[model samples]
Target: MSKSYKKHPYLKESSQHTKYGKKFANRKVRKSEETLQHKDYKKQYCSWEISEYKFYMSEQEVINEFFASRNEEYHWMKKFKTLKEALTWWKKTYLRK
Candidate 1:
């Protein structure tokens, strides 16, 4: 007597099934990794570059530029507690003048 084997329905061969299974397996592996740390490092590096550029400007230059472009309605300029703060605002807001 020959032994008869029962085949599982889920194991049926189909091109679409094989393609979907491969894609699902690849997606699972791709999602299981750290990405935030790299992104944070990139953001920090960008911020550092901006600060370095701002710091490169001389204090006198910042002050001169600030007063040259001071706006009467922008009262926030008075609230700046430090020269650096005022200078930063000035560079961003009024340096074009």
Candidate 2:
């Protein structure tokens, strides 16, 4: 019947897409809120756990911070003798994309 066509055809599919879009937007908002909260909490409380990690302007620390968790990429980091070399490698590997 005409009623069934209007009631069911593409109606469920469109509603599902809308729900998924809303969920994705909500997750993005929650992530941004979490980042803001973390920054605020860090500023309010000087925890030793956060202070334990020292800031260093060295190649090894840069490599560890940026590349070490990326599996195969970090291996190349170990081979680089200087920060310039590492940076050049990073630019070549990442910037082209």
Candidate 3:
């Protein structure tokens, strides 16, 4: 396939990328196991969005803002006094290997 600079047009001028802005698999320039081009081909989408990158919550903010609409029936959140505490518990439970 012709890997022209149409996809990645802004590769910084350096040895890391080609003169035409095409990136190559290398020991230094770590390759993304899941590149955007591969994802577009699989989904057959004209455009794509990484929905996981979107953040509705502010850093160190209260959890109340998120659950304002959700009533007390969401008793699971009440266990933590603050958002940090909830995140800590969640990380410990879900992320720990």
TM-score, candidate number 1? 0.23
Off-target runs (Cα >4 Å) in candidate 1 are 7-13, 16-18, 34-97
> Which candidate has the top score in TM-score?
3
Considering summed lDDT, which 10 consecutive residues are worst modelled in model 3?
4-13
The lDDT ranking, best first, is 1, 2, 3
Error of 1 at 15 (Å): 1.7
Compose the digit string of candidate 2's lDDT tens values, residues 1-97: 2211122111112333245544554455556544555346444334432222222233355567445534564564567666677766644433322
lDDT for position 2 in model 2: 25
> Which of candidates 1 and 3 reaches a greater TM-score?
3
Q: Name every residue pair that clashes in candidate 3.
A: none
Weakest 10 consecutive residues of candidate 1 by summed lDDT: 46-55
What's the lDDT for all of these models? 0.46, 0.44, 0.40
Residue range 7-69, candidate 3, lDDT tens digits:
222112244333332222221134435455534443432223312222222223335543552
lDDT of 3 at 40: 47
Model 3 TM-score, all chains together = 0.28
